[model samples]
Target chain A: MSGASVLYDVPGPKAKVRNRIYSVLGALAVLALIGFIVLRLSANGDFDPARWDIFNYAGVRNSIRDGVLATLQVFAIAAVLSLAVGVLLAVARLSDHRPVRWLATGFIELFRSIPLLITIYAIWVLLLNNRTELGLSDNQPQFWALVIGLTVYNGSVQAEVLRAGILSVPKGQREAAYALGMRKTQVMTTVLIPQAVRAMLPTIISQLVVTLKDTSLGYIITYEELLYSTRLLAGNTTVGGENPYVQVIIVTGAIYIAMCLALSALANWIERRGRRAKTGIGVVEAGDVGNAGALTAAVAAEAAADTTADTAN
Target chain B: MNVLLDYLPEFRAGFLGTLAITAASAVIALVLGVLIAGFRVSPIPPLRAFGTAWVTLLRNTPLTLLFLIAFFVVPKILFQGASPFVLGMLALGLYTSSFVCEAIRSGISTVPVGQAEAARSIGLSFTQTLRLIVLPQATRTVLPPLSSIFIALTKNSAVAGAFSVTELFGYAKLLSDKGYAIAVIFLWVALAYLLITFAISGVFRLLERRMGVAR
Candidate 1:
């Protein structure tokens, strides 16, 4: 068969044999690696039926369920809170007031440059130090710490994403809104933000996925989140003279992956819808703005474009 | 605060630890990423499937979960287990490698079909075409994103602290437990991280400008 690929030519007889050999070898290598892991774990009694039986317990199932609920709780609170913080920071950074702009920039830069694990740890520590003064219960500190830490770091990131979206809008639209005698705030609310939010919906939702994944960080501060719960259960229970860590970790990891994948699927759907919608401005594939590094590149690119436009004018 | 000043040597060690983790993990991420990108683009269906599975599963799972697996689970399977330092490196490198793989694949796609066709017409094999005609150009596009990934990696190295790796975050954690002023400890810790992050972005930015590819 003739090949249509630009990368490779249609295989001749020898090439066909070689390709088949490569396919078999590659599959074997992959399967062998996986098989080795399973065999090793099996030798270690990790896959023992007794070890797996932990999940069959009602209390164990409830813990897993509670873990899911807690993870979702943190995600829900962080998602809404981060979005709100994001909008505030984005608008403030773009403000005409120099002080506000600088402050916003400083806040975003500080939290972003620091690793979020550190931020969350710091907040958790602070809460512990001030638990009595704040009138908080013992458990409240970790929950608030994780929430606030995620809010600050993710909010800064979302601000940059939102700013990029707003900047992607053509100057003519903003000017048109202004020419209609709308105030700056009115023009922003009516003309810019709605379009920016729509254009950036996918990026925004993807950030929420990051938030969801980051909730596992709550495990660090001993928050009774999903990861924390699963870990606690694993550490507390033992079968066949070994903790069910392998079974527990794998199961919980699957739960986290499923939740994130569902959210990512949602992001893809929104992006597809945005593309097909009658909007002239194509959002294109800004899909991976999920990471700080990617978002930084985007905001920097946006800044670069604005400067070039200014230079051209 | 004198907390940072007093523990200058310890802080320096911690800083070096963070750098060590970042550098080692970065090497892993880059190498694994390139190989996986090759897999994704390869003609072998199994290779492509493996590549897809690697990225999807690794990228979606939390890095914290990865640390748990790296520490508790991988040990049982791999047997004898390495030090936490090595485990932390593996976890961080493996996690970041997924992002790196996606970046490289996207970079490869931007190399344009015409270039590959031209290479094929000139009798270049797929590997040679990718190496000679495609990847050289793709590097320009790939650098900016890779910079950010590295910067992100620098920040992420802090996570190693939680797992007993004693990087900057762990050092800060240690100090906090010692009853130092939290603000003082964090201020120093923050500065150390900012230094690393700025150095990464600056180097990448300079390289990007030298290459003259802002995007």
Candidate 2:
């Protein structure tokens, strides 16, 4: 609040000034580093017209495009499955039946405890070993491995998020739903889960971002995802050169950054929309309102005077 | 099960390698994470940006990708070779630091600004304020998340097997390649990993309760 800010500046003037100076110096140092890198790169013929021939290789582009698509396919499937799994696990954990709760808890904890990469690797190894007997293909083995691994780990996290969201819902809502003679399942499905999800949309979105980022793990099983494609590019015998490695890495990193930033932007938009949809009654009222408002205003004014007095010393 | 027994020594060696990689990487991650977290919150804009960019880049890429980059790309560019163990540690360290940075940032944010002000008001220097007031509180609040990250780190170290580091899973794979039953060896490997993870989680839970950090 403006009044609160006036009363107690978050960081004092000295610290603020020092911070600004340090920021400017730091920015310049980084700019200089970038400039140096650019100059060195160009001098080393990294940006030469000859090196542009590498992109003309159709196979390179095709593989990358396919990799991108495959990555997206797995990510999309995993996200939806993980969220569904999370919701089921959350509901079961919250069930009135002791066995259901314990089972859900154990499932969530077990999968979540294991490393995601290990889970993926284990599943892949298992599928590969059983493929001949089960009449499955190599691709299915890796694909299923990635999907199941992502689901189990992300689902557990989502369960925790969902549980927190559900607990955050007021007790009165559940009681009222039950009073209406709604069965437990109906109360949960119609009342608790929806409200909890709506309330916890940001956390859910954040987890989704995490899930999207995690899809790159498919690279471990040689799933030919975006990262694997990039690895192929790095090791390309066709584009042999002194230092295509850094260029490939820098470009690949930028692509990843672009996608992640897009996801973050989407999350920000969703958060804004969520805030806009809030009912007036549910909003946390600022302290500078109601009967206490007058007292707070006076106290704030007194605090401001004291701050000024201290600063003038 | 007999297949597992036949390769008990290999499993033992693999378990040790896994433990070594996980512990080494955990130490590196914690130190790297703390430094990066500090840089992220520093008043310096470029340092903060660098930290943020580092976290973003690492978090977005798969851990396997990082390992490949370290093993394949880094050595290629630097015109040197890094052992699989070193490469795995470097990659895991880098990857884990991003999540750890976020955790530390969240923890730092949870510490009341009033606390810092109170420390400063009492004539404590900025360094002293951070060391005594800010860090202790941040470390406490971030314990559970930190523990979870450690467990995740241990699991992720399994990726080292992919690069032929001969860790637990890699060991199991070798046993299978020698015409042994894979399902049996894999189950043993999985159980080994599960046991380690459960033990770590148990310790974490106990610590959390003792520290009154449990919700």
Candidate 3:
């Protein structure tokens, strides 16, 4: 086992035993700590089930639901807009024109560096001053500000992800497109982007997941997202000296986890589909045009040839 | 503007608390992140699983919820109760550790497999191999994303305000509650956050250039 195993051997029995011990110890420590806290809370009567009843109360229900809807609305708008903005900037940055590339670089860097909170707060404050002129009131300012701020920051991040994905497409694909007498724009639009995007769909979906979680930042500016709703509910309800805040917080946290897990599942599915379809479409080999497995072999051959050329030099 | 002057003491305390929390939590998270990253890439399945679950939960959930659980739920579950400051630090450190884990793991993965094998063949112990052969290379790859996460943590310190922790934004909220001019108070709060953010980004810029030269 020792000699035959490669340097990065997938794990042996001793390592497995050691891992189990560590896991058990860690789990016990955390559970014990939790137990101690629960015991103390029970002694203080904080753990009484009566405290959680406010969750079922009509006012709390309405506010929480309304908050969820508002959060979803903002997330939907920002996710779509950010992807569009990301692609535009990614393309601009790749543009051969000097000014287009410069402008794109600056825009991405400026928003990417700024904290999302400042962007939202700044937009909120700025809009507040021009509320009447813009035909809006105070409440509208917070909502719009959250949307715009999230769009800018997430959009910048997405731009980088998209650019990396697009650039990751092999040079041969671009050269072959050009070899066919295709224009620069035509090569990008017709040949490179689709293949690059398919290759990078997993990373793109991962960013969208980040965008969704960032929506909770809207709570800072009082945009009434899920966290905000929970806070308002917790504050407005009273469960004696102990505050029913703990139960309400756990419930709300679980909701967020559910949404994030759902997004991850979707991303995983897309990655599988993309993997199956990737070979048949990119850089068509003359002899392997209709055969899927043959296309993979053709690509592998091209890659091996390229490596040989580099080594031969 | 006169309203802004009334809560100067609260604002000062909040501002100082936020800075202290960010610095302390950032340090703790960096250390924890490195350890978790080691566990993640360890040749042990259980360790790898632990690392994976920690990253998945921490990265997936909103930081605000983490703050709440640390401040309210965890305390109720652990000590029956805890101070907002302790809870805030715990939450922020734990939350930041996850991102740190990801960045460091990415950094470590970028170091070629052959490098580690070469270190081992030369008679380096596992720990020595990591310390001498692996980490320096990983640090360079990790700096940019690590800086971004640090900036994020600074902004997230504002969430402590929600738990009644008197960070900068907490003080601003206090002033607003006290009938001070909301705009002026928030403007000052924004300035405080900006000063911290800009300073962190400035340091990262210097590091990036120096690393570029070293490479």
Candidate 4:
């Protein structure tokens, strides 16, 4: 993509001189903001050496490790569960049966409309109150609340994403499969879903990243996850006669940023690998799955492009 | 359901509080999103770098972590006596703004290159080209994604409830703690949120049609 740089003219002699001034001033302004924050934080003991020493403690280190592990455990289960839920819902939404399609639609939209915190808390309470009646393990409410909540919300989102991917597959592929005497289920499973999964891998992975980030919400329900662990450490500790919230924040925040960036980098790498693997289909730059109108247009554009490709072949 | 009827005032307050947070944060996210989008596409390298850093960091960090920082760290390090509502707005707005910036940036990319080149050829400055040509077209086409982001902002405003803002989602705990049934509380709260989200979706649909944005 040539991008939006063409909005400006090429720099001449006077423009070059002005550009230098703007660049210098811009750099200085950014640095100044950074400097101001640093100064303010230091003045508040955030940068005190003692505040930074908490990580050296074995207990603190262990707490963080456990927190990260718990967070990942929840994320792993939720990610898998959500993807499973997504596929089922997407298929049901696409089902030929009217009632089945409407039920899936209703379920997806209902969960999507409600915030996840409410869902998790509601599920937690319901599970707690009905533990005996539902025959559920008592201690598992927090874990299940978080897992089900993430599963439902992310699953709904992924359903839309997968549906978009499915619809974007050229109509000829499904038609060809049907002409070969394939059953509807066979056509969907062997033809549509695989290609849909492949085409929408980037979007699917990014949504997974969202799930990973959202695992932090476990702190809200006292799940003792990463954020909760660090929060306890931050709240209970004292350094140089003051709480080192800023220091804890900086460290905890960095871990999150690092984890997320690593995931994103992996996604980019996989996408690049996919492009190099002689894939006939191109990955559409997917945006919000909730944009049904835009999604329709994008998928249509993709199908048209693939149709033209088929003609050329 | 009777709990909601009995506590109609509390329920109404919670719903209105949620709306207030969403509305306030929506404004902040939009303004910051636009400014950062400009910075991302600007000629100045450092400004562009700053914009990229802002989006990357904010987008990666979870909204809960942001709210934690806003509530805990900011009060101690930056300023004291900052209300939870203000801090929640800043946190939610800052987090959502990254998504907003990305959407707008992609929208910028979708504007036909010929439009920009044509405006540049007419001796228009960068800002002039953006104002007169690029942004108008970009914003028009960008509504669908923008609406999605704002709807996300509305849902995310629920995170504020956990941060002690006593919004709609926070009412979940309140009504439940009062011995009301969880299912009933969820039904009413879910309905309230459905009202907000559907209203948001409906408004955007109206706006999209009014703008005659292309399908």
DockQ of each: 0.54, 0.26, 0.22, 0.53
User: What tens-digit string does per-residue lDDT give for candidate 1 at A1-313?
Assistant: 0222557777789888998999999999999999999999999888789999988899999999999999899989999999999999999999999999999999988987778888999999999999999988968999999999999988988887778778767789999999999998998889888877887777777778778988989999999999899999998997967789999999998899999899989988988887788854655353454222222235646533222111110
Tell me the lDDT of model 1 at B167.
83
Q: Which residue pairs collide in model 3, if any?
A: A37-B77, A37-B78, A37-B79
- How well is each residue in A16-56 modelled by candidate 4, as lDDT tens digits? 89988999999999999999878887777677787798899
Off by over 4 Å in 3: A1-27, A40-46, A56-59, A175-185, A240-242, A276-313, B1-20, B41-50, B74-87, B108-144, B158-215
**RMSD each, Å:** 4.4, 9.1, 8.7, 4.7
| Deviation in Å, model 3, residue B75 alpha carbon | 5.2
- In candidate 3, what are the lDDT values of residues A1-313, reduced to their tens digit? 2321223434459756865686777667656766887787687676677887777788878888887788888899998888888888889999999999999998886665444655676677677767999988757888888888878877776666556556556678889989999999998888867775665455566667777787887877787888887887787788775556877776777778788888777777765675567463433211111112222444433322221111110
Better of 1 and 4 by DockQ: 1
TM-score of each prediction: 0.94, 0.81, 0.74, 0.93
Report the C-alpha lDDT of model 2 over A131-233, residue by residue, as the tens digit. 9987888588888889988898888777766675676567788899999999988988998888767655655666666677678778767887888787777
CAPRI-wise, candidate 3 is incorrect
Candidate 1: misplaced stretches above 4 Å? A1-4, A12-14, A290-313, B213-215
| After superposition, candidate 4 runs with Cα above 4 Å error | A132-139, A286-313, B213-215
- Candidate 3 residue-wise lDDT, B1-215, digit = tens: 56546667776787799889999889989999999987776654556667888888887788767876786667545654667877888888888898788777767766777787888778775567777888887788677667767877887777777667778876765665565556677667766776887888699889978876343
List per-prediction Cα lDDT, in the order shown.
0.83, 0.70, 0.70, 0.81
- Kindly list the per-residue Cα lDDT of model 2 for residues B79-125, writing each as its tens digit: 36768888888888888888777777767766777887788678775
Q: Compared with the true structure, what per-residue lDDT tens digits does model 4 show for residues B1-215?
A: 58888999989999999999999988998899988998888887889899999998998898899998899777765658988999999998888788778777877877888999999898899888888899889886677667667777777888899889969888878889888888889989989988887898799889878878554
